[model samples]
Target: MSKTTRATQALQQAGVPFTVHAYAYDPNAERIGLQAAEAMGVDPGGVLKTLMVLVDGKPACVVLPSDREVNLKKLAAALGGKTAQMMKPADAERITGYHVGGISPFGQKKRVPTLVEQSAFAHEEVFMNGGQRGLQVKLRPADAVSALGAQVAELI
Candidate 1:
């Protein structure tokens, strides 16, 4: 079944071509990103996991591949900040208008500064959370950067 989300709506409005993917979410899965990749039959490298982080006390997003973890020091340096840390799940949910396991860089409640890992562009398409659990949005890496107004960095 296909449905719309704030993210999908934004993509459409931006004239960004994309495909919606819906899957049965298994709450028991140990890793949401990996599970999403497995469920969608895509490479983990093509799946981006959006992380909410605080760079020098301000909110920001780091979009990186599911197979990698954000290097906080490097990200902070790239953003010209003294320190960076992951936002708490509750704070992240409250800020992004998305649940912990389904945060997307698009359609966020607040326009937080965002950094997209340069490695994401290595793939033709990226599969990322679609503003909700059990759904993902597929789009070209360039489209994602344009849509999010993100800066490219070596975040991972």
Candidate 2:
């Protein structure tokens, strides 16, 4: 698979160091993130999933451990919003300029407030979608936080 992607380009532009990894993407998998972790032979917690959400009807991005689930109430509270809900797949794709399974927090068509799970900082590096299916970018969580201007919180 080609290593170049908007996500990778964004990282490069930001001067953030990262490594690109390619894995078999399974569209049929019940859980895409866990499937990625298993394919990469890495801990699930170190594989971050990018989610498109609407906080008070405004687009937002959320990054968290593959093995964890977001608590919408907690997420909304953390963002100082009254409600949070996952964006419809079509809307997510439209907003992020990526397919449902290939959305990455970086290089989205629209820049939105981003929230990253605080627990992700436990790892020296974590993997996230590289703006395409079958591709991942591994980078320091700190770098990602800075690059995305992401708020770190207990979103799980």
Candidate 3:
């Protein structure tokens, strides 16, 4: 069998329902989540951004509200680690098998720990990068946690 892209293969195997939204890609963009929200005409707050962080020397995924920044102190406390810091871009790409702007919490090269902001659980559905830039996947936050085996925590 041939391997499919991370977004498609992971969602299909997990049986998680999701909708894909595609938009024009911009290479010079800074905040990918904001750009995606604007392109999709959705509130930026409803879109989530996936970040790679090193917790106790291990890479982990941290999902947070697009409108808010990750609180490293809180994330450290949640993970029971003394400190947490953003991973290097190259390291993130190598571990996630996706570029910086396209990293998703769903499928990764390695099954690193994942933590999502508790606030996201309040929304009925949320949008996140679909393992690629200019593409997003819409699904329930609960399903995301289930599919990724992520823990719910106050990451932002």
Q: Give the alpha carbon lDDT tens digit for every residue of 1-156 in model 2.
A: 779988899999999999999999999998889999999999999999999999999999999999999999999999999999999999999999999889999999999999999999999999999999989999999999999999999998
Task: Give per-candidate clash totals.
Answer: 0, 0, 0
Q: Candidate 3 residues 38-139, lDDT tens each?
A: 888988888999999998787889998888899998998888898999999999999999988888887788888899999997789999888887888889
The prediction achieving the highest TM-score against the true structure is: 2
Candidate achieving the largest lDDT:
2
Better of 1 and 2 by TM-score: 2
Candidate 2, superposed: residue stretches over 4 Å from native? none
Model 3, position 101, has a per-residue lDDT of 87
**In model 3, where is the ten-residue run with the lowest total lDDT?**
1-10
Q: lDDT scores for all predictions?
A: 0.91, 0.94, 0.86
Model 1 worst lDDT run, 10 consecutive residues: 1-10
TM-score of each: 0.96, 0.98, 0.94
Q: Candidate 1: where are CA atoms >4 Å away?
A: none
For TM-score, candidate 2 versus 3, the one ahead is 2
Candidate 2 TM-score, true structure as reference: 0.98
